[model samples]
Target: MSAQDIARMDTGEIVEYEPVTPMELEFMIRELGARLENAVPVLKELWAARYSAERALIEEKAKAVLRSDARTITEKRAEADLATMTFRRDFDAAKETLHAAEELQKALASRLMGLQNINKVLGHAYGASR
Candidate 1:
């Protein structure tokens, strides 16, 4: 997509992003990085609330499944018993939450790295200008 499109696109919507010019890219990267660096912790808090809500629901369902399995286990160890039907469901949901959070963290980290790299470029740019 075009640079304008890249500028507008959120990280999730990114199809592909690569710098066209080192100097210009550095500027853009620095700007974006600085913004993200400031926002990372806030975004993390948001994610925590979102995922906690989701996990709560999943955990309830998982508990129900566990109770059911506990009641059923002594009679027979069926597919459901070995399957971790309850725990697995909860685990999967939690895993997804964690994975999403980690992705966000990585994105923020990338932005910070970009900012640092751009700062170096900016220093040179100003030096040259002087």
Candidate 2:
């Protein structure tokens, strides 16, 4: 996808973001990081909720029913790790968010630098006339 697609995500509903300075973009990235961390607490919360309430019952019933076919907790967890892959969606989202922030920052910095160069060139040309 292009930078605008990423920038749109960063600004939520505002694809046409206001003029962002490099410093402002830096702060926006920090805010995005904090928000992402807050959004993803469910990862640990889900693990704790499942492991606390259902681990013993699930292990017992599965072992009794399957006998030799039953897998150990570690094996089951590993399988579930692959099967659920809980972090996949969150990881992708975070990557996208970070990428959007990075793109926005780059664009703002470039614009600021270009303006500075233009002013410098104009100043030099004006000085040469004297």
Q: Please tell me which predicted candidate would have the highest TM-score against the true structure.
A: 1
Q: Relative to the unseen true structure, what is the C-alpha lDDT of residue 13 in candidate 2, on a scale of 0 to 100? A: 34
lDDT per residue as tens, model 1, 1-130: 3434333335443324555565656656665556556666866776676666666655565555565635565533444344446555665666666666567557656755765676678689979999
Model 1: how far residue 109 lies from native, Å:
1.7
Candidate 2: stretches off by over 4 Å: 1-78
Encode model 2's per-residue lDDT on 1-130: one tens digit a residue.
2335223544633243332454444444444444445545644454454454455444544544444333687665555445434444444455555555545555644544554555566567769999
Question: How does candidate 2 fare on TM-score?
Answer: 0.39
Q: Please list the C-alpha lDDT of all candidates, in the order they appear.
A: 0.58, 0.48
Q: List where candidate 1 sits over 4 angstroms from the true fold.
A: 1-15, 18-87
Find the 10 residues in a row with the least total lDDT in model 1: 6-15
